[model samples]
Target: MRSTTTSASPLPPRQVGEIVYRPRVPHIMFSGYHHQPDATLETSRDLWWHTGDLGYTDEDGYFYFVDRKKDALRRRGENVSSQEVEAVLLTHPAVSAAAAIGVASDLGEQEVMAVVQVADNTELDLKDLFTHCDRSMPHFMVPRYYRLVDAMPATPTGKIRKAALRETGLTDDDWDAEAAGLTPTRHH
Candidate 1:
């Protein structure tokens, strides 16, 4: 169920790409999307079911899933890992939970963004967060846009529902450091 590339060629470990699979057994593949022929056609291409999950395969053929294809962001020619950004955000005391998503950009493929949740009665300081992230991450990885929420929309299993957050992306309500002329100059 995990594939790095469609071609049968040796690749270095952890070279991330869309994970895909084709049934190894005879006629064991899933039929089609229920009442969604378009989706099925889109998915079943080149004899592989393209899983939207981004991942990589090791030399041992073990697959390591990274980010979702849509969740991955490229900012100013730098690849930004959402999980890495979220890890730094979670270190802040004011941040109870955070979700990093890609914002549509006219200048590039996408820009980095942070959707965060703070505890009730707790104040989330934008300056401090900017400083914290500036110290922990490179400039390209630091979020360009930030939005604070009372609580994050979550999946049934308690995972942050980033798909839902993407619905409200790059909102006017989000605090923009660049607009305020406060985009931190990266030191590390």
Candidate 2:
């Protein structure tokens, strides 16, 4: 079932929060967590079922998925949105689609790693893509590593399966911009 948020007011439906919440219904709500009384599924106050998913709302009231709560990356003490990074990457003419995932970093928190699919018949240059990102996004949000591919894995419903990419982690073919000593200076 597609998770939805219950409208807070009588006004038209709009995004209430990051987590998807649905009102309690007989058949709709589950009968609590099995054998885990401490693991109640309902939130503190509204009792809305927590979906663990994170997303944003468009101006037209459409919910656009960003990433799962677990997939959120903590880099340099900031929460970097994978979808936000992908959106910037897509702006490049050579990029067709992109997926940003967090990989373990020696500094303790996760570092950004992006897997990008280049446009048909276009060869992606790591330096050029890095330049685009440096000019487009914040320095910390820039990926430390990148992997160019022909296509990205997607679900039957057309959603990018980020978990699969995260499962693979880093690869030998992935280019490491940080290791190469290419530091992105803040453009702004």
Candidate 3:
């Protein structure tokens, strides 16, 4: 069985659970939506404010930010990490930055969509990037949709706002591998 205790952390300890916000000082704990009690169904068990962030602790007691719980992709009967996909995409020579999001798919639960920014004076070839992803990662993790942009929306601290990208959804300029009739198969 997995240990219930977390690794020793300087702040609160590294936890592999929901990041809750609870204060020792007296304060009103916001329980649920303004008028919708049903919205707080998930918090009924613990009553702690869930931040929706998922992370883990290393053996030596270090906390690493994995991705947001909502950002996880269920693809081809497997859970794919968006951060891992973006990391692989960033390895491409033409790519300056990347964000991977899960989009609705006809074949499975969801398909990977990569929104990327190319290096200055560089042209992005969706085919080449797809080929690289196919060679570098698992077939299921390969992005089915590609969108190249001049810049990714980020915060002042330089964190990409993937939620914003997700909100934009697909555009006409975006390239779809399946729609384009390109088959990427895995060789067993």
Candidate 4:
């Protein structure tokens, strides 16, 4: 067997395990779910490492992440999944790629907005696309605003540039208002 070693100096010690918030330490506690009852650094019996992602377990022991604490959307008392909306848009034959973002609405809730890249030489009917969404997805999940572009802005690693999209609000200039003739119903 080949030996495994790092050429550089050893890195500083770091804690690993399931992280729990502790008010006393003003620091996070990490312990293995299957190993330690007390979160102590000296304990070395953990089977899993604590990730800083905020999550909790129910009484039945099912764990769920509460989403990124910073960039969560609050839409009419419902939490919208941007990823799920993007996935639905990708199913459209005309859409080559898509990104969904939340925009603040006048009704004190966020609205789903989509930026879609259409296939080359393909022109999609906006009304048909909206009809498709209405039939397939829940009403709340449908994008309130849509923008079509040649391609989506992406990072070096091929991730959609959500920050850039969020910075640019959904305005009439960005949309083909004539193509999307359906008027949006004003929500109170």
**After TM-score superposition, what is the CA distance of residue 76 in candidate 2 from its true location, in Å?**
1.7
Clashes of each: 0, 0, 0, 3
Which candidate tops lDDT? 1
Against the hidden true structure, what lDDT does model 4 obtain?
Answer: 0.61
What does the lDDT read for residue 100 in candidate 2? 92
lDDT of prediction 1: 0.81
Ten-residue stretch with the least lDDT total in model 1: 1-10
- Clash count for candidate 2 is 0
lDDT of 2 at 88: 89
Per-residue lDDT for 1-188 in model 2, tens only? 13334423222343323554666566676657778766673432255555666666656767766566766788988778887889889999999989999998999898899899989988889988888898889888999999987778999988788989999999899999988889889744
* 1-188: candidate 3 lDDT, tens digit per residue: 01113212224344344444454665566646777777676543343455566666676766676667788787888767899899999999999999999887788598899999999999878988988888888888889999988899999999898889889887888899878777666542
**Candidate 1 vs candidate 4: which has greater TM-score?**
1
lDDT of each: 0.81, 0.77, 0.76, 0.61
- lDDT by residue for model 1 over 106-159, one digit each (tens)? 796887888889866789888788888888998888887899888789888999
CA displacement after TM-score superposition, residue 93 of candidate 2 (Å): 0.8
The residue-level lDDT of candidate 3 at 161 comes to 88
